[model samples]
Target chain A: MAPNGVNGSSGSHRFDPDFTRLVVENMGPNVAPRTRQLLGGLIRHIHDFAREVELTNDEWMAGVHFINSIGQCSTSIRNEAHRVSDILGLESLVDEIAHKLVVEGDVEPTSSSILGPFWSPNAPFRDLGSSIIQDPNPKGRVALMHGTITDLLTGKPIPGAVFDIWQASANGKYDFQDPENQTPNNLRGKFRADENGKYWFYCYHPTAYSLPTDGPAYKLLQLMERHPMRPAHIHIMVTHPDYRGCTTQLYPKDDPWLATDTVFAVKNDLVVDFKPKEGDPKATLDLEYNVILPPKDYKGKL
Target chain B: MAPNGVNGSSGSHRFDPDFTRLVVENMGPNVAPRTRQLLGGLIRHIHDFAREVELTNDEWMAGVHFINSIGQCSTSIRNEAHRVSDILGLESLVDEIAHKLVVEGDVEPTSSSILGPFWSPNAPFRDLGSSIIQDPNPKGRVALMHGTITDLLTGKPIPGAVFDIWQASANGKYDFQDPENQTPNNLRGKFRADENGKYWFYCYHPTAYSLPTDGPAYKLLQLMERHPMRPAHIHIMVTHPDYRGCTTQLYPKDDPWLATDTVFAVKNDLVVDFKPKEGDPKATLDLEYNVILPPKDYKGKL
Candidate 1:
């Protein structure tokens, strides 16, 4: 029989008596209620995992050392812990849980997606429809993208919504990754919607890219015999005074890796077509998308 | 309905569809069978815990940053990750699982305990019955501890058994912790058993001590309103050519924190009395203990 509070209807295994007690009652009296709850569940699950596998001492030590190495590998330029989480699908999982659709009456909130590891707070704000690809020797077809932001419940345009947009170049490199070839803030821009709640930008077509392979995250991927590619996509974050902020990504519909993105951030609703344009001399492709945001007064559990 | 391959009889919670798929099918084709099994259960439990609490994005980010800080806090002299595991009761749990008692034909094995974080591999060797407390101004009552190592199955002396012993000073400090006052290897010694499996050592009585409070581990303790004291005990590791190695600790019977040791390393069978001696010229107290070891051929699951 399983020990009391060990399995506790959340697992189907028995544990040593002392371990069970430690997991069930180790919390101190002064811990906040929410902290207590979070820790209790975390402890139980970790203990259960150990028991389920009958983990050896050497294995446990290896895990300890692995965590230490990850710490040692981190620097201001790289976050190995975040990379580990991304490869393990934890970041995507957290995003899905924290940003579930908010329903107020009959309105549907915009779909949420991964913030990924490349977001920068210093993206330069630009005028509407300005070219974000400032490099003299750009490598991809030019595209015109436009989007509008609206309040979900009121169906009214949220004028002056700020849109922060960024993506990899056609060569699958972000600005930071190719400092010698790409100017600072290349392929990254922040634009404000006009009085009609519509915003537009000119940039090169984004492409699929593999994560850095020299790091521990990619090493794990190699060990698992898995790919490191994220799908062709563009990232966008919209914010307005009267609405809750929305951070999301837009994937090309025809990208072969859409269903198998290593980060698991893709959703069917977030995929769009990059259609060919006929009448623009400076742009070869055009795409249109719209976003809906929850009202600031929305009171709903996430 | 619960998703397939997720919490399938092991847990009692529902998960987001994508999260469930990631937990169930995230392993790659090249992953070892054992690794796949371990990771499957681990992913499932982590997801369940997140869903159970509706973990917020801020909380998730906080956890990520906390882990990174633990990594950054580590050094050659300190392992903050290990310290975190120790305070969370994970080290004790792993010890209990890895060092289970071994029972052979008609023989009961000796009880095992934690090796703790203070052990050093550079202890000096000494003759039988040597005084380990070489400090000229020792601060506590002197004690003589003697023990015999015998084969559990036959109750016969195990010749040439080596005993490695260490303990904190009466002032509740280890040699390394007070280098300004204590010699390099004070209070640490190794001795070999006689033909009769007998060994003895002289040392000062140990007192309960608190862990370092300035690091992240103790900061967590403070936040949880928990004390950081470990019960008074002497650490020992016994090894013989014809028997498996045993690492354990012996606790005094009268320690105030015996039942509430912060590390939870105390076992009922490992606690002993420290009796006062009437006329010991070199000692004020005496304690006698015995250890039983399984034969070299003993085979048991841990």
Candidate 2:
């Protein structure tokens, strides 16, 4: 049942049809039920795929090498594996299915979205209403974002809610993605809701960007002849001891490729307007949104 | 649709449920039909699996890292991906389905097994009845293996049929798998059937051995609580301009893992006896196998 091991012969011949059942049933009892289920399902689907194509050794080898290349393309900051998942729409489906499970009760929390590979866990911590702009001179108009965190069921603000925020500069690159041109953590920071459950920050507006095209993941897109564009968006994650944490992205209302998002992270509720602001010299654009956090013990959704 | 990219938006919100159809339908027309079918099937299955498990973000991240690890664990000689395929019984099922496509008519060629990952295409050539044991002395009794090549339908001899043969040494290590202890090409060679369609060679008998226990593949086995031992096998591949090529393994009768070959490669006809022969010092053991090669244009089973 191990990935490197094979078959169900006790030193004798093995039958073809019986092989699948044997492989799945032979997993030792020590395997956790969840592991057994996951691995069992995986093995069945893999076998089905091979049989459907009558896959040959050459094709098998091709698959093996591709899997390895995806792994090789991954790094701490860039997950090529996640990219493959996205390309295959696995990530999108998971996002949707996970959210639906949470929206079970009448009081539905805000839909969750994928965190994506650009999230920086170590972004600098900043005070409320401060700018995440790390570069002295940054591109794009200044955009102010403010949001409140409240319990979904009780409609009460949750104070001290943690938030991790990150976005691409107008040039369409994250700090680490364009290390030579952008300072580390540029337009990226961590903030917490105040006593009033309000948190605010400012950063350069976002723009549509192309995914990395230099890796095996890109080769897959080329094979499918699918384009590799993601619309402009800001990632926001909120967490607190009393509430279920959420990781999501807020999409600007005007970029192209929304319906054809390669990862399927978009939801109507998560889309908001970044209107042009006037009076305040510090802000060229302003937006406001609020999050409905579910309770921590909620055996709810994604 | 690149791996590192996500979503479709003209810069607006996206609705759920429409994602899968959009993603698939959006693939460019340039994608080859077979590529489309294979990739499309893969995408659907991957999405289905993720939803079946209601997979979580942590689980998804774990999968990404695991995929990367499999690639990192692989090399030119060791295919952890193939090992994983074998573990899931995909290799075995593929073998069965391919072979079935060939057994359409009454005349059937030999069964094809997995080529496995240890094959070296550049083995030294050996004369009929020559020894693959390059070392002056070797472990295990000498195994004298001789085989005849003939057309499955005509039952006629096929001369000059090429054969690539390899097997683990007495210590259960292929040359590359045990570089420090085994000499290059130490029980491996290539040969051509004589005008009579007969080919023979000798080598130190093989023994059951463990798969590499130091990689991700091995980790999978641990999770499944499966042993890594493989039944002793002699890798044999035969090809000719006039016939369909076959890559298979001959299981030595009496090996304990025969029924449960880690790769599920064992076949009844492919299992042969290595009987003792006391007459000449060069004939400590003997084996005879006749290969039935189908025509090169054969639209036969594997």
Top-TM-score structure, candidate number: 1
Cα lDDT tens digits, model 1, B104-165, are 36556777887876888999999987799878454588889998999877899887899988
The 10-residue segment with the lowest total lDDT in model 2 chain A: A2-11
Off by over 4 Å in 1: A1-14, A102-108, A153-156, A176-178, A182-184, A297-302, B1-15, B102-108, B176-178, B299-302
Give the C-alpha lDDT of model 1.
0.78
Give each model's whole-structure lDDT. 0.78, 0.76
* Model 2 chain B weakest 10-residue run by lDDT: B1-10
Q: lDDT by residue for model 2 over A158-219, one digit each (tens)?
A: 99999888888888888887888788888888888999899988876777888889998889
- Candidate 2 residue-wise lDDT, B1-302, digit = tens: 11111221111122244555666787898899888877766665565456555677677778778888898787776678878878777777776765654355685687888877778878998898799887534566787888799998788999999978998878787788677777999888999999989898887667789888898877888888787888988888899998888888888899888876766778788888888877868868888888888887766443
* Fnat for candidate 2 (0 to 1): 0.61
